[model samples]
Target: AYPILAKHNIKPDYVLALERHDLVYQCFEQDNQEFDKDILFIIASVAHKSVIDTLEKTKKSYILVHRPLPFSKALHMDDYGYLGSGLSVANMAYDLAIKLGHKNIILIGQDLAYDENGNSHPKEYLHTQESENDRKEGLFITAYGGNGKVETNQWWILFKESLEYSIDTNSVTTYNATEGGARIEGSIEKPFKELCENLLRENKPLFEKPQTLSEKEIQDKKDKIDECLKRVVILGRSYINECEILKSDLARCLENLNFENQDFNPLSQRIYQMKAKFEDEEFKNYFLDLIRSIFFHFEYKIAQNYTKNPTNIEEEYAKRKEYIEIHINWIDFIIPHIKLQIQSIEKGLS
Candidate 1:
């Protein structure tokens, strides 16, 4: 989009990015290489390190921003640019628009549906290149004019829903000027040309580019990030040790195989102890996404409340063993995963 805008001699003042993965870097590497270097790229601070390195190497104008959760809770907004919203960079752009005091928001190219070629994103994005596969797995939604259905994947469906929620909650009015594609429920679907004819006149510098932060501001943010990452490392190590203790306690209880007998109190107490350890407000706030991701992979069926009306002691014992083993396996997995996370964050600090 930046390169295309540049091609037409229209460079947007800013290009916001919310992706924390390397794909954002891959996008710049694959295509869009001719992007306007002057366009400020407001990136999430948690974004892959390679992205920051690549932007620096290419001399692209960029700045890192906090992603709301940990930063909004722990750090001052003045430390880093506040980049909220998780769904899409476009939504973050909305926050920026509001900050700029724009009461009217005009959205363009928010198709939220596949193009004629069946691609959800630009052709240059390799991640969405397999349009046929996407079409096979995707669902259809009502199109803009309500006369047809447009094919869209789950992710775009989510983005559309998020935008509708934002529009409903925000004080500003949203004009969806895309002219086609999946309908945004709360936006006024006016044609771009029609809106331009009515609302736009030959403008005489309606807005000014926001000022860049001074060296002292950037240095302050760096110091804050360094402090937080060190604390995360300490918390992560403690969490890993706690999980190991729980696993060991569970193992001892499982050796006897009966929830009603032998070492039961010890195992239950260990699990209860973990609840308090993890419930630390600072740790939970800092690693909410990490906790959510781990839980998402939890095997809920097996760990479900005990077998209903077990026929005998043996049957109940077997069920209890299965449950304990599942938890131990989960602990075994996360201990190493947490270590890796610590290592990764540590590298970034370095």
Candidate 2:
């Protein structure tokens, strides 16, 4: 506990744990509140059931925890799953810090375990392990690889992806003791730093720059979308056999809802075509609409909450505004993914 906390050199308002491991709790107990009482210590893990059962009698805010909701797994598996937990950490930290009126927060030891020798401990071992005994069983784990070099590439990939997904205008200076994972991945594995850096840099110049499309670029995008669409149309021919069965189920639902135009074929086909051969112009319009719609929904939700039942008036107002701001920033992160996917499809067509 001392080593872990000391290694980071900074204290978190909340210590989030997937499981109430004895060690984690011990650390929580030993550590003095360097931050404020507002910083919550949350414990969440699959094994939290046992802890909750045992400590049911005691009511203390110090040991606050939440279980992973099963339904949420469908949409947010990556955010809460084994590999996704790292991303969750960054997200939670950022949220907690922002709530506490912090602007610049440091991300501590997000380093990945190195693959020294041929054998090495995997970072995901915690999520994959079935029981406490299993995690404990791996104590004698050793590596077979010859070189004793540590590689954090895998951990870095997930960390960067998460940070990209969660980071906002707030300045987060990640203090990496070793080589920063983002730099290594961007430089070595792929020539993606130009794109990633442009998107992530805080100067705001990139955002303020004019978004004008060249004729050649538009034409190129059009040709690629055409080719991709043809492939999707072809694929739909193969799905015709199952269409009859699926339609029956779909029709029943539509009818029950008192829908008039019961036509899934055209809608499904259109969506397939759009996904396969997306028109840059059409996509630009559609994506903008989609994003704006999401933003509108978010704004309305926030506004409704603030206007209606007012709880934690100040905190709620701050959170509602902050979340809306995060949504806009998140749109920036999503743009690259959309562009890349479109580009990949275009290249495939070419």
Candidate 3:
């Protein structure tokens, strides 16, 4: 658009801008209309029940672009609008120009902020402002590359096509200004500049330095684990007390204990070992299997003997207490080794 306007040395009398929001279209209509006036109409989707009445009542036209599906997908167009390689807003503008039946359309203020005069938009503007009495309201050409290294080639594609078409004598004149977007490339642009004026900030500095912990940090972790162990031991006693309450019925008590012990033992041991094997991972799984088998056996025994031998409850309590003490000794021995493992980890980290 900028190239076309520059080729003919013509500044546009009317400009047509398209956005999806009707309210925004209305704002541009009312406010900017008093300034270097151009007709700005919102091409809203039929899906949005936007202020259609206001659009209709306004002096400018409010066109509805119909689509098969609802307009949910188009909401993210702002983020991905630069995806196309060559064809972008230029193609759209061309279509729009043809649709509006305008043979002599001219564009302005689209200068993408580049200069054929060996200057960037800022430098040129600063020089111009210093020398000229009155500042120009807008630029005339559309240029793409910014101060950043990561260049967007989409603008190049648009400029390529725009320049090629501007050579035609019968077509619209395109004028490109040096700068276009509100910010440099790769910078975050807030949706509404006025509303988010204070919210937007400069990009955060990247942290490239390595992060490492000190020897003291590693030792501190060991001390924390030691503190945790003491609390766990206190709670272990409470669990033992709860286990004692179910000891009155020998079969029921054994079944409950068997289920509890199965975590350290398993049913597969009952078939292969016929007894217990201790300490190894295989032994641990076997132990759980053995406990499950015992639980099953006790349940069967309880159902069979409960009616005839209900008074065997006293003997059952004694046997249960004996096994409880055995478990406590096992736990006391295992705790010291567990503490050693934690110490080893701390030493390794240090």
Q: How many residue pairs clash in each candidate?
A: 0, 10, 41
Task: Point out where model 1 deviates above 4 Å.
Answer: 29-38, 75-81, 122-138, 202-225, 256-260, 306-308
Whole-model lDDT values for every prediction: 0.73, 0.40, 0.37
lDDT of 3 by residue, 1-350 (tens): 32233334544433333334444333322322233224334243432334455445444433444221212122222321221112334434544555455543333233333334423333324234233222333333323433432222345435545535543433443323223431222222223343235433555344243455588975775566454444333433443333332222323434565433342233223312322323334333212322444445544544444344324655555444444444443334433443454454345445
TM-score of each: 0.85, 0.31, 0.24
lDDT of 1: 0.73
Q: Could you arrange the candidates by lDDT from highest to lowest?
A: 1, 2, 3
Stretches of candidate 3 exceeding 4 Å from the true structure: 1-17, 21-26, 29-61, 66-91, 113-350
In the range 283-304, model 2's lDDT, one tens digit per residue, is 4332342244544665565566
Best-performing candidate as measured by TM-score? 1
Query: Which ten residues in a row are the worst by lDDT in model 3?
Result: 77-86
Q: Quote model 2's TM-score.
A: 0.31
The window of 10 residues in a row where model 2 has the poorest summed lDDT is: 135-144
**Residue 313 lDDT, candidate 2, scale 0-100:** 52
The prediction achieving the highest lDDT against the true structure is 1
